[model samples]
Target: MTEQPDSVVNDPNNYKLSYRKLILPVSLISAGAISFAIPPMKELDLSAKIEVAHDRPGKTTLDNYTQYFPAVMVYGLNLAGIKGKHGFKDRTIIYATSQLISAAIVTPAKSLIAEERPDGSNKKSFPSGHAATAFSTAHFMYREYRDNNLLLSLSGYPFAAFTGVYRVLNNKHWMTDVVAGAGVGILSTELAYWLYPKMNTLISGKKKNNKSVVVPYYQSKGVGMSYLLVF
Candidate 1:
């Protein structure tokens, strides 16, 4: 006779949960709160003015680096086969929503603030878009991949920091702009995570426990050898 599964297996608390169970909605709400709170600080205006006055040229290189890093990171993740699995889809949703929100907020805010760029050019600078994008992407990576390994979580900080640095170095934005941008990125990621539950149910699926084995083969001096291992 076949053995019956234990009653504990069907217990409500015994089911496996996805990473989204805790992280997704919480992150979203947190991002929203931060985004709402950052815009009214008075010190940002003073710092922005100082940065614009001292701005110089030839710093476009930093801007270039900042602009391309997100694309590179996305490509790297894809190559690692991490995308489309293990919260990849959720991350993509976060990125897309963040991008949209950043663009919507930054463009209009820049125009309205009329805060001159660090380059001292026209008044189209307030909250650096590049910095915002970088932060958003970094936050997404952190939330999605941090659970996979600690190194991935650690890697996000440097990228987010550099994005702010590049904006300042390029003289395209002030310290205030970079700070606000960072806030925007973080907020966007959190919003995405929060909305994920209602937006898509695929993210809620649970994985089954399984095991795998691998075998290796080598050829030398016209002889072949093979080895097997189980995981």
Candidate 2:
């Protein structure tokens, strides 16, 4: 048995159940939802304006690489001696889950809405997948290292924003599509963070004093010792 300290029990960071903490994230989602539903946004001419402003003949190849840059930066930061909120296992799980959630939401929305692309490529361009990927990575980086380095943590958003811009410039998605994708991406990461603790409990029990264990098993002529380490 272990005794919980008062500070640990009362820590708002642990539960994340406060209205103050949720206001910004919820606002992001609500803004996207309201904008997507409203008449002004429905008949918005911003996408055409952008295409007319920056329409070029060449294809945008850089955006494909930039979309995943934020996620790579998180690992780079960890390798460069910057500490994040969670360790390798938790971060991996959260990142993977966030991408999955983003995909699940984006895929069906595209199919159901069937919005036409800016360049008349296809009818499945309501929310930009590149935008979703970029923002998800941005939020993932933000959640991980915000405590250690605020500026570095914030660096991901610019890249994500650039990705959205490129998507519009490339005539792949509209401004509304990018905005909705950003909201979906942010919400996915937020949901992943909220679900992390529960996932940790289900995958492995709470941290223990002796976090390293080696157990041996033998089955007919086969024997092996499994080494388990938790940090």
Candidate 3:
């Protein structure tokens, strides 16, 4: 019997590219982009009708701050002796890079689109920043705790959804804006995951003919992965 070559089985370069892996993210981003061109998307009469019942009756006056709660919960859980998917260094880099990428996408798009807010506050309402932060944080929490505690991992989404809902209820953003923001947030985190592996290798000076399989470092002064920013 012939033994299979280790390089053939274990090489990252040998991995088969699959379109199935891209379906979810592509569909989500497409939904967001298509909303801009389609008539009925802007004509979301249902959302407009719901907006009339506005103002969170019992929620705190500082409701906008709720968007950051998911991220806080991630660290809180870590401090509470919960082991996440990554260690301190990997998680820190991945989470921070995710947020950084989100800011990059949201800020420039906001300036370019310049859509007016629901309450006529300003023209930076095309994509909801609160929703972006909420979802990105939620995804971070989800990725971290998912393998350890499914319930805790799933809990992040509701918090993120609530933030988006609050944004709409408070007349800060439109429904489409919320949807697009969600897409951006999710995509940002996914991109970070892809990039971190490569970035780690690059930063660690571990490129031998540029063919090394990227790995996360576990010790001080060790190299980590580079984050891929794929949309």
lDDT of each: 0.53, 0.69, 0.66
Q: Write the per-residue lDDT of candidate 3 for residues 1-231, one digit (tens) a residue.
A: 221111111244322334653466556656655767887877782467365455345534344666767777876676666767765455655776777777777777887988888777888886777777788889889877887898999788888888888777777778778888887777777777667666455555532223223222211122245443311
The better candidate by TM-score, 2 or 3, is 2
lDDT for predicted candidate 2 compared with the true structure: 0.69
TM-score for each of the candidates: 0.59, 0.75, 0.74
lDDT per residue (tens digit) for residues 148-168 in model 2: 788889999998998888777
Q: Sort by lDDT, best first.
A: 2, 3, 1
Error of 1 at 186 (Å): 0.8
The C-alpha RMSD of each candidate to the native structure, in angstroms, is 14.4, 9.9, 10.0
The sequence of per-residue lDDT tens digits that candidate 1 reaches over residues 63-134 is: 545543653565366555654223334344445555566566667766676777656777866666666667
lDDT at 63 for candidate 3? 41
Better of 1 and 2 by lDDT: 2
Candidate No. with top TM-score: 2
lDDT, residue 165, candidate 1: 78
Better of 1 and 2 by TM-score: 2
Output the lDDT of residue 128, model 3: 74
